[model samples]
Target: MSGRETGATAYLLREPAAGDVEGFAELHVRVWREAYRGLMADEVVDALSVETFRPIWSSIARAHAEGAVVDDGRAMLVAVLGEEPVGFVMVGPARDEDAPAPRQVWSLNVAPEHQGSGVAQRLLDEAFGDGPGYLWVAQRNSRAIRFYERNGFALDGTQAQDRHDGVTELRMVRPD
Candidate 1:
């Protein structure tokens, strides 16, 4: 909470700024390469490294400038580390026709350098906010599966195709 700890050590999760776009997109490109290199096709992941991906900052800035809040009944959380934007999680109503209700994690990504540092957990804590929610992860992403399991999410016996890579994924959920 102090300036010293925050700036040098502890990560500070906050609304991202439009200025953060380029940096975040850079981090995203790097981290995705680290986390998905072998699990996904190299060409597909490489495509995401383009400059247009910099919209990350603009997207977060728009939501922040609009005064979007957790209690505002929407589900989008962007995590920042000190002066740098590092990760983001977006949640929205479940889109699957068989889902019982609305409210699910649409996406979650953390910079590879920041993973295992409790950043994703903090993001999930904010996104779930005292309720049940669901998310999907590539079935082959054993690391992420363990991370979600540690946070109390369980396999929901559902599966889907990942639109970006055409990989099979499992739907997982945590009920409050």
Candidate 2:
């Protein structure tokens, strides 16, 4: 599916191809910095780089091309606006042992410019359908928590510390 706003050209959501690795990696780093800057330490945010993630994306693209299922059992979908990759979502089997749902939203990110343009919702709809799922979100990221709530997820009272930075994350789940 694609989204058509007033000024911006419509964006298409599709399975990412190997050629998208570079763009995806770049977008990932940019969005991570923009999204986590205030929530995480400056040093942690500054440490993010495209180079660190490019190899991982390359591996994903390779596995996708070779018809090998992602070891994490997730599907990676990218939103392309013209030639630029604007957003992406990763969804699959729950990684947490105690998750209430069978699936989880491993990640969802949109460029700052496209944040309020419905790109995230479109990606969520495409990736999650009407089924139940769950995701861990930074407890302090109110925008994302509200977005998930508006999309039918509710706080499940489960919390954990992120292993890397020790930031708190809360679990949100959608009923089956």
Candidate 3:
């Protein structure tokens, strides 16, 4: 019982089964490694594994399987080019108390080779639907910041630092 799809790729957005968990986890790791290398700490990047993505995807899959749908709801969208997953965008209601209601992009990642092919943009278009959206990006991730900016997201001047991880993040938002 996942959210409804809006385009020709509806079938690609199907509810993920328990078995799909592994592929989802693998995609997360692969895309992160391919997309974030050099942008993030090599140690942190190398330390990420399927184990880290497992719980994250498992929770999303479970929620998509059981959560109630809302008006302007949000969900995860994985884009597969042929049989291989090339990108994924996790979107939903803005959880940040500082953000406007409606849609938020918790994360968006595309394989380095597959980027600029509209995979990420298509996923965002489907999930956010021209609505107001917000996302947090690591401050050091200049590439992502540019991407977000190019997509119309503006810096909202919010910042936070992870005490344990020491990563700095900036909040960006877009009006509907």
Question: Which 10-residue window of candidate 2 scores lowest in summed lDDT?
Answer: 1-10
* N/CA/C clash count, model 2: 0
- Per model, state how many residue pairs clash: 0, 0, 0
> Whole-model lDDT for model 2 versus the true structure?
0.88
Q: Which candidate is the best by TM-score?
A: 2
Candidate 2 Cα outliers beyond 4 Å, as residue runs: 1-8, 70-73
lDDT (tens digit, per residue) of candidate 3 on 126-147: 7666767788888878878888
Question: Model 3 misses residue 109 by how many Å?
Answer: 1.1
Q: What TM-score does candidate 3 reach?
A: 0.79
lDDT of 2 by residue, 120-170 (tens): 888898887878999999989999999999999999999999989767899
Score every model by TM-score.
Answer: 0.82, 0.92, 0.79
Tens-place lDDT digits, model 1, residues 45-139 = 77776375666556666767777644634666667766777778777777788774457887789887777777777777776664777788888
lDDT of each: 0.73, 0.88, 0.72
Runs in model 1 lying further than 4 Å from the true structure: 1-8, 67-72
Ranking by lDDT: 2, 1, 3
RMSD of 3: 4.0
Which pairs of residues collide in candidate 2?
Answer: none
